[model samples]
Every structure is written in structure tokens, then in C-alpha cells.
Target chain A: MRRGVLAVYQVLLLVLLFAAWHVLVKLEVLSAFFFGEPLQVLARIWEWFASGRIYPHLGITLLETLLAFVIGTLAGLVVGLWLALSDTASRLLDPYIKAVNSMPRVILAPIFAVWFGLGIWSKVVLGVTLVFFIVFFSVYHGVREVSPVLLANARMLGASKRQLLRHVYLPSATAWVFASLHAAVGMAFVGAVIGEYLGSAKGVGYLILQAEGVFDVNTVFAGVLVLTLCALVLDWIVTLAERRLLRWRPAGPGAAQS
Target chain B: MSPQPALALHRVSCRFDARGGGTYVAIEDVSLSVAEGEFVAIVGPTGCGKSTLLNVAAGLLAPTAGAVRVFGEPLLGLNRRAGYLFQTDALLPWRSVRDNVRLGLELRGETDADRLADDWLARVGLGGHGHKYPHELSGGMRKRVALAQTLALDPKMLLMDEPFSALDVQTRALMENELLALWSQDRKSVLFVTHDLEEAISLSDRVVVLSAGPASRPVGEFAIDLPRPRDVSEIRLQPRFVELEQTIWQALKREVLRTYQRAEA
Candidate 1:
């Protein structure tokens, strides 16, 4: 019964927000040209789905995001583990790594376009750059933070160096990597959309860019709403995977009570 | 013919670089041995480097001086013939209870890892808890899983560093009795380290005491004449047990007091 009340309150909040948006636009407190009508934006989104006009664009964006996420995550895991285990190499490369990670990676989108020539590969490259650093740092710290006692115990139990890497280091890093994946996924989407917005023939970002050029505020809002929904869905999938993999963890207080 | 000691540390010393740019000796000239199938407990004041001595025997730390021998062979790298029960929670948090127990066998690439894990878990009295994770269990249960994990490989020697110090008194005694029962069956060499004098006397065939640290060494040793198949809780009531405790505490009290004075200074 409490959950039902919470659900009703949640829906009421969104309804109230949209109602306010509609009222302000109708009263001319906010310009319809700039903000767009709430009903019109919803209708535009509905029409795109009803006519299946958003499928191809959404598919392209999602494909780019997924490819970027997979390649970036794999590269980060391998490089993070390698660098973390090798002390001298990590020490030597420390400053360089910090410099590279600190740069505004969004600026790479235009350069990637120049190199990969406005194709899906350019967007994928940009997305990979955005996702890689988040995972890399997380995994690096994870491997370094492994409990020394646990390592010693494993060694005494006769674990070889290779076995230690596989059983101890990798699993410990995996937990940290999973924790960073939600942000990494969001970064991947941002990279792909920004790449498309800058210069692209396809993707939801391109559709929004086209609508903006023609002053179709409703279509632009519709495109943004669609991307937001897709990002939420992807994040939900990640949370589900995290739950399945991390069943060994004790549930937090909020989850335990529920 | 006499069998060689299961593990021997000869003139062992460990020095650490202090944060203040000077060297600090953790243990100095600490020689000890555990005979085959013998249970030897090392008792000392807190911060007396007892765990450091155990680490040396386990081959996890290389001594600044002296040598370690395992079954009359010079030890190298890790002590492959020994298992270590750490004081802290060393069980892999990502693995379930059964998987943690199977870790040693898995490292060796044994084919029957699952069966061995299940059998050892049952032996440790965690038969129905194989599926639960470490966080789901109580502190005593986690220690049992750690014990099972260490013993699953059937190592010839066990090196435990205050393994039950974190548990409550009742749980600690119960686990001690269980460990004694298991040790009686297998008869593996054990080097148990703890600050609790009663626990050392109750559980061990012999107790070795170390002096206060900066550079700690063995100050005294006593043979416990208690009979076999002893219950750790009930053993303390025996007159002989009390007498032994008194004798050992006389040597230990001085070092413990010296440590306290040093700390105060």
C-alpha cells in the first residue's frame, strides 16, 4: 500500500510538471517557439513511433553506443590490469596518463570526423574515448586496493602468478569496473550524440539537428525525450546485470528492508 | 629415527623502513620450530610481531637474516606445503562459501574441487551454508569457512595467526574445540599465534612467548602436559592447566609490562 502511494505520487509529480509547462506556454510566460508545446512534443514523439520513423536513427545511435562501450571496456580492463600489476611501467606512465585523461575528450569528435570521415566509425571512436578513462581509472584503483592479506593467503594456498591474476586481481577489478559502467554507458551515448550533432548523416542526433535547422522545436524535444528514455533503459539493463553478478554482496539497508 | 621438523625458522629477523627515514626492526633473532604433527602456539604482547614471525614461516615475507626450512628442505617463494589462516577476513567476497573453500584446489587445477570443497565445508560444520556468501553468515561462520578453505587442500602444515581473536568468547571456544577435533584426526603440524595466554595453553602442545617489540625474540617456552582430545573451555579448570598458565604468565607478564611502559613513554 505504501509503494502504491509512492507510485501515485511519482506519476503525479511528472503530470504536475508537464501541466505547469503547458500552463506557462499558454500564458506566454515562456515562448512557444523556444520551449515548444508539451502536447505537441508528445504528439510528435508518438507520431515518430507510430510511423516508425525513429527506428533507423535510434538503431544507428544504439549500435554506435554498444560498440563503443564494448571496445572501450575491454581495452580499459586489459590496460588497467597490465599497468596496475607492473609497478615501473605504471610509475613511468603516471603523468602521461593523467594529462591524457584530463583533456576535454569531447574535442576529439571533430578530429575523429576528420580521420574516420563522418562515418559510424568516427562516432564510435569518440564514444570509446569518453568511456575508456572512466573504466580505466576505476579498474586501476580497484586492482591496487586489493587487500594484501587476501593476496598473501592466496599465495600461501599455492596460487601461481597467473592464477592470482585470474582469480584475485581480475575479480576484484571487475567489481570496480561494474560500478563505473553506468557512467561509462552514459558517456558513450553522449559521445555518439555529440558526434552526430556535430556532423552526421544518420542517428537520433542528426534528426534533432535537422529539426533544429527547420525551427521544429517539437521534433527536437521529441528526439531528446527518445534519447533520454533509451539511456534510462540501458542504465536499467546495467543495474540488472550488476545485481546478478554481485549477489555475494550483502544488500544495503534500503534494499534489505524492501 | 626422529623425523625432521615440519617447519623451522632459524635466526629470523625482519627490518622495516620507518616512515621517519630510519630502520625499524620488527623481529630480531627469532628462532622457532614446529615438529611434525605438533601443535605449537606462540604467545606475546600486542604489537610484539607474532604475526610477522608467522609470515616468515609461511614464506610470505623474506627475513632480513636467517633461513626457513620446511620438512628439512630450504623454503623458497611461498611455503607450498603449508596453509595460512589469516586474522582478518581473507575469504574472497565475490565467491560463495563453497567457492571460497574450493579456491586452493582450484588454484592447483584439481579435477575434484567441488567434492573436496563440499566435504571440507561439511567437516567445518557449514554443510547447509555452501550457497550463502560470506556477508550473509555470522563472524564465527566466516572463520569456519576460512578454516575450511585453508584445510581443503590438505597441506602438511597450518599457520594460523590469531584466527579466532575476532570472535566472541563462546564462539571462540567452540571453534577451538572443533579445530582440536579436526587436528586430532589429521595430525598436521600447526603454528598458532595469539596474545591470549589461556587460549595458547589450552589449544597447544607447547607455547612459545616473544618479548616486546622494536626487536622482539622468543623469551620463554613451555610444554603443555594436557591430555589429548581436550575441550578448550573445560581444560582451563584442571589444576595442571592453571599451574602451567601461572608459570608461562610470569615470563609473559614482564614483556607485556615492558611494552606498556614503552607505549606510555
Candidate 2:
């Protein structure tokens, strides 16, 4: 019940901030050219939605983020489990893994663009690179963190090799995966937008770049607002999933109701 | 002739390559056995290789030397006929209490795994708490869940490493009583390792004392000759129980001091 009230206030705070922005611009306290007119921003967004012009761009950005997240998470889980479980493999590849992970992976965006061209694939690949490491490191530590006692207990309980992976290893690793889900999803979105901002045929990021070129502050703000909402939605979805999947986790950061 | 012992370790040893330098011999030439339906406890000072021996019995760790035999068969890999109760919180936190109990049965392809899990849960005095997760339960409750999880498998032997060491005096005694009640039912061979001499004497048919680390091994053994269905708390007040403790403590005291002096050094 208190949360229900707090949620209303949260929306109220957003409205009050936007109202202050509108009133400030109306009184000439802030320049509409730079700060942008909130009303016009909302109108532009409505216009884009009404004409359905924003759908394909929104679709492309959303698709890129999603594809990157799924593929990257899977690749990270498989590779992380393999390397972590195998003493020889992790030792041999240790330095190379460190080198690749430490290198500024964002710099690879241009190369991905060249390889995949100015399409959704380039952005998706960029997002995957960003998401993969975050998840890979989490899974690596997670698999290693499987309490030796617990593993031994499972083995003594007659769990086969395949059963160990499914029951003991996968569940343990997924806890670490859920802990990093928000950051991974956020990075995926960042990768897609940064990829698009650098050069792309369509995406909300592309629209913002186009608006900035002509100095149309209203469209730029609209695009920013749209992307912000999308990020919030994705985070909400991650929270929901973490709640359901990690229900057994002691309530703390990941499973916090608030 | 008598039947083969349920578990036997002849001249077993464990040596670890210390992170800093030379091999650390945790235990060496440790020979022990638990006859069929016997409950044996190994007690020693803290840091003694009591747990290492238990691990060897569970087949979780390979002995550096010598051999481990289960029912006259040379053991290999994981012990197929034993259930191990770890000292630490070893339950899978992600699974519900019932699911944790159900996992072993399901792995063996039991179609009625859920029913069996519920039966074991009820047997462990946790009949209504099956839906609860490990983290949601109190420490004692979690221990009960672990007990249920281990016992549900119906293993021929149990390898317990200070399983109740973490519980408070009250909970520990309660669990000890429950364990005795259950063990009396089937009388599975038990190899329990602990530092508490009282706990060992109260729970086992025989108590073995280990010397301090750096080649810890059995230094003494005593048969309790305690009667059946003994109450752990009540048995302690008996004159015979006191007699056994005094006898074992004399031999065990020197080893405890050795461990202390080694630590001080």
C-alpha cells in the first residue's frame, strides 16, 4: 500500500519536473533552442507515433538490443562454463582473455560497421561484444563459486555429469547472470545507440543525429525521451525476471521488491 | 567369519601441494573401519584431518596413498553406496526444501520422486515446510532439510563431517536425538567426524581420536558400549559415559596440545 502511494508520487515528481521545464521556457528563463520545448518534444513524439513513422526505427533498435542480449548471454554461459570447469583451458587462455576483455571493446564498432555494414547486424554485433564480457565474467566467477561441498554433495547424491550441469552448475551460474542482467541489457542498448549514432540508416539514435545536424532541438529531445523510456522498460522487465527466477535468493539488491 | 566392514581405509594418506612450497601431509597411514550397522566417530583438535578422512570415505577426494574399500569392493570415483552430510550449508539454495530432497530420487529415474521427497520431509519433522527454500529457514531447519536430503537417498552408509557442529547446544542435542532415532531404525554404517568428544561419544558406537595435523592419524579408540536408543543429553550423565570420556581425553589431550603448540609456532 505504501509502495502504491510512492509510485503515484514518483509519477507526480516527473510531471512537476516537466511542468517546471515548460513554465521556465514559457517565461524565457531558459532558451527553447538549447533546452528544447517540452510541449513540442511531446508533440513531435505524438506526431511520429500517430504517423507510425517511428515504428521501424524503434523496431530496429529494440531488435538489436534483444538479439545481442540473447546471443551474448548464451555465448558467455557456454564459454565461461567450459573455461572455468577446465583447469588447463582457463590457464592457457588466461592472458589472452584478459587482453581482449581489458582492451576498449567500444573501439571495435567501426570495424563491425565495415564488416557488417550500416545495418542492424552491425549494431547487434556491437551490443553483443558489450554484453558478452559482463555476462562471461559473471558466469566465470559464478561457476568457480559453486561451493565445493555443494558440488560434492550433488555428486554423492548420484547426479550424473549431465545432471550436474543442469541441476548444480546451471542454477548456480544463473544467479550470477541475473545479478548482471540490468547492466548487460543497459550495455546492449548503449551499444546499439552508439553504433547507430556513429553511422546507421535508421534507429532512434539515427533520428537524434539527424535532428542535431539541422539543429532541431525538439526532435532531439523527443528521441532522448523515447530512448530513456525504453531503457526504463527494459530495466523493469529485468527486475521482473530476476524476481521470478531468483525467488529463492535472500531478498537483497537483486530481488528487492522496491 | 564376520561380514566385511561397510567402509575400510587401510593406511590411507592425504598430501596437498601447499601454495607456498613443499607438500603438506594432512594425514598419513590412517587405518580405520566401520563395520556393518556400526556408528563410528573420529574426533580430534581443530584443523586435524578428520574431515579429510571423511572426504576420502565419500570418494570426493582420492587418497594420496593406500586404499579405500566399501563393502570389500575397491572404491573408485564417487562413493555409490554412501550419503555425505557436509559440515557447511551445502543445500542448493535455489531449490525448495522438497525439491532438494527430490533431486537424488529424480536423478535415479524414480517416477514418484515428489512423493518420496514428501515422505522424507515429513519423516524429518519438516512435513509442512516442503515449499520453503533453504535461505528462508532457520539454521537448524536448514540442517534438518540437509538431513532429509541426504537420508532420502537410502544410501548404505553415511559419511558426516561435523554436520551439527555449527548448531547451538540446544539445536545440536535435538538434532543428535533425531539422528539417533533415525539411525536406530536402519542402523546404517556411519563415519562421523567431529572435534567435540561429547558429541562423538553421544552419537557413535565407537570414538577414534586423531593426532594433530602434519600427518594426523588415529591415536586412540574407545568402544562406548552404550545401550540402544540412547538419549544424547541424558547419556552424558551416566557413570560409564564419564569413564569413557576420561579415558579418551587422556590420550586426546596430548594431541590437542601438539596442535596448539604448532599453531603458536
User: Which model scores highest in TM-score?
Assistant: 1
CAPRI-style class, candidate 2: high
- True contacts preserved, each candidate? 0.94, 0.92
Candidate 2 wrongly placed segments (more than 4 Å): A19-30
Q: Candidate 1's residue-wise lDDT over A2-98, tens digit each?
A: 9889889989999999999999999999999999999999999999899998899999999999999999999899989999999999999999999
lDDT of each: 0.92, 0.91
Residue B232 accuracy (lDDT) in model 1: 87
Q: How many angstroms is residue B165 displaced in model 2 relative to the true structure, after the best TM-score fit?
A: 1.1
lDDT of 1 by residue, B190-260 (tens): 99999999999999999999999989999999999999889888889999999999999999999999999
lDDT of 2 at A171: 91
lDDT of 2 by residue, B1-265 (tens): 2489999999999999999998999999999999999999999999888888988998889999999999999999989999999999989999999999998998899898989999999998999999989998998999999889889889999999899989999999999999999999999999999989999998999999999998999999899898878999999999999999999999899999998898999
* Steric collisions counted per model: 0, 0
Q: Give each candidate's interface RMSD in Å.
A: 0.8, 0.7
